[model samples]
Target: MIHPVAVIGAGPFGLSTAAHLRARGIPVRVFGEPMVSWRDHMPEGMLLKSTPAASSIDAPQRGHNLVDYCDAAGIPRLVTDEDIIPVETFIGYGEWFQQKLVPELERVRVVSVDRKSGPGGQGGRSGGGFEIKLDSGELFTARAVVVATGLSGLAHLPVELRGAAADGPTPTGPVSHSSQHHDLSRFAGKELVVVGAGQSALETAALAAEAGAQVRVVSRGRGRVAFGAPPWEQPKLRPESPFGRAWSLWALSYYPQPYRHLPAEARHYLVRRVLGPLGAWWLRDRFEGKVGVREVARIVRAEAQDAHPVLTVQTLGGRTEELSADHVIAATGYRVGIAAMDFLGHELRTQLAVSRGTPKLGAGYRSSVPGLYFTGLPAAASYGPVMRFVCGTEFASPRLAKHLAAAHG
Candidate 1:
């Protein structure tokens, strides 16, 4: 059967896309379990880095906002000066959105998507739809596709860590990325070392410390940085109000041409300056003294030593030290690459044109590959860094729905 649109990855972006498409009277088949990544990967006690107001799914009216959901549920509507929104709350909010607004989603995994041949050759018709092949061997055609498989599916671990685990069964002590960490009980009373200084790294370290493990964090940079407080200008920036402060920032910061004009070094520098050094306020009190932060150090190598792993690390003062730990946790971020997706057939994966390892997306989030489109973090480079945040759906959903409607109409 042919649907007007097929939305992949049932996270916040995918569900939002589906909701908007449905609202536009377009038929959409959404795949994957709702909030699967958030439910499985994130630690239980972790709080959201952003606020409820800033982290909302794109809805037409203000009635469905996160603030309203919290109020209806009798949960705290206003955040404490120290407390950021918890991950559990955000997940609940997502579930609430899915149940109330977007309920027509099918929990299936899409293995591959290929362009179909039409009556004419090569390029095919401009609006010709494409086919999606599912894991259950089901085939469905759609004029457009939206890829919202978020950060959960694509984690980046160190090369040495991957090689060690590849030789045999993955050891309980060998898990590298934060996405792989589920339970804290396993590391109790053990010497644990965590890498990276991002929010994930700090949170994981704190959890490990709370689990009674001897925890140490090895950071290549200075230290964990955090945002001072929920910026007062955020509420005024909602996308619904075009002339608001948020929209103005979005216009200046997210527009492609201006961002592209900045040198890569400049962009990195700006991100480090503005968004860097920011973490949840609660984290500072929990991890400050308990989690040992080793700055200006790099893990040069890692190898199994006496049935455990020992890392050769270089400190900022040009001093070399070897530290042995019972377990190592790498909170390193994700690698966005089509090569990592084994489900894609060689031909189809290669055929899809890419820009800096991400699928090149049109104005409507549709890729050069007719039916396939990519959203979320992968779209950030093209659409703007805001795409990496949940707020991006406000812009992505409506624009994508219009494209699908035009193609199917």
Candidate 2:
């Protein structure tokens, strides 16, 4: 008898892991809407930050790449790092990958995950495996659990903007996170303020202005917004990494397993800073002349005045001023916190050894809690920044699947 493994997400990592596991003849049940984040959470006009080659979802079988999807779907294939892939195209590719590779994926949400107990159970550890509860109230057991949900519940709103309102930032409220908006066009003919200098903030500001909204983009730090050089201008001497063309990035991209051997502080610093907050080379034209930018500025105070949000900003030269908008979008980016994974039972959360709110992963990306694993952003702290991108699936999925097959076989 074989007990299936439970994959909790249907994104690139989840789909790829399930595909690899199935190839190894492992029983698997995957849950969550296919590419739901890309389809519903991201704004309509947004483009992928990753290049064409970097955006393809990994599969055990050959010919299931984005180029293959394009060939099958009759769309033009983006063949190089210079070619920009649209978010819609990427989302479609992921869904197509799901259709081809993980047809057994369940669309229900997993409400809770806990250790299976009773006969031969040691402490809260499951003797027969783990129990999974779905949103539909169905319960089942799996030999192991792999968490690959990318960026869910990890949106970070700066404390300065968060303390402004009584109810705090909400999707419908005066203040909202960039991840909360699916369409910035709803703010058309309205005053919009975007906080942070990252790709999200710049793109949101540009898109809002394009939709005819009065837009003001604020850089959260004391520095101006930045962009990568055009593809042609980039030097070709350095080896290529999934994120960019550099030695550090190349190591991170291809040699992620060794990242765990580095010092804890060094690992943490690299994860936060590498591939940090900059727009793609292609977004320059759409952003530069179209949106107003406030550089080297900080939002010192925030308050919801009546129904409108007002910000007290301090600029580089110590100048202070008030700025108000119909809505404030915080593009502060995401921080991985394992505690935010509320669907995981309290006991599992407690038993799992963690560092800085993330699972302390060993070889095969296994957490201290046996049979439980984490991937994607949650694995970045242990594996390095490469895990934050779609291309990391090439390394993470097959490796974990082989580890599981050997462990259980």
C-alpha lDDT score of every prediction, in listed order: 0.70, 0.86
Cα-based RMSD of candidate 1: 4.0
Candidate 1 lDDT by residue in tens digits, 311-408:
77788888888877887787877767787765556776888777556666666776676666787877765565667678778877777777767755
RMSD of each: 4.0, 1.7
What's the count of clashing pairs in each model shown? Answer: 7, 0
Best by lDDT: 2
TM per candidate: 0.86, 0.96
**How big is the positional error of residue 140 in model 2, measured in Å on the Cα after superposition?**
0.9
**Per-residue accuracy of model 2 over 1-409 as CA lDDT, tens digit each:** 5678999999999999999999988889999999998898899988888887788888998999989999999999888878888899999999999999899889999999998774676322346678899999999988889999898999888788875656756877879998888888789899988888778888888888899998888886733688988777777998876677789888899999889999999999999888887877888899988888877457898888887888988877889998888989998888888788999999889988988998999988888877888989899999999898899999999899988777665
lDDT of 2 at 39: 93
lDDT of 2 at 202: 86
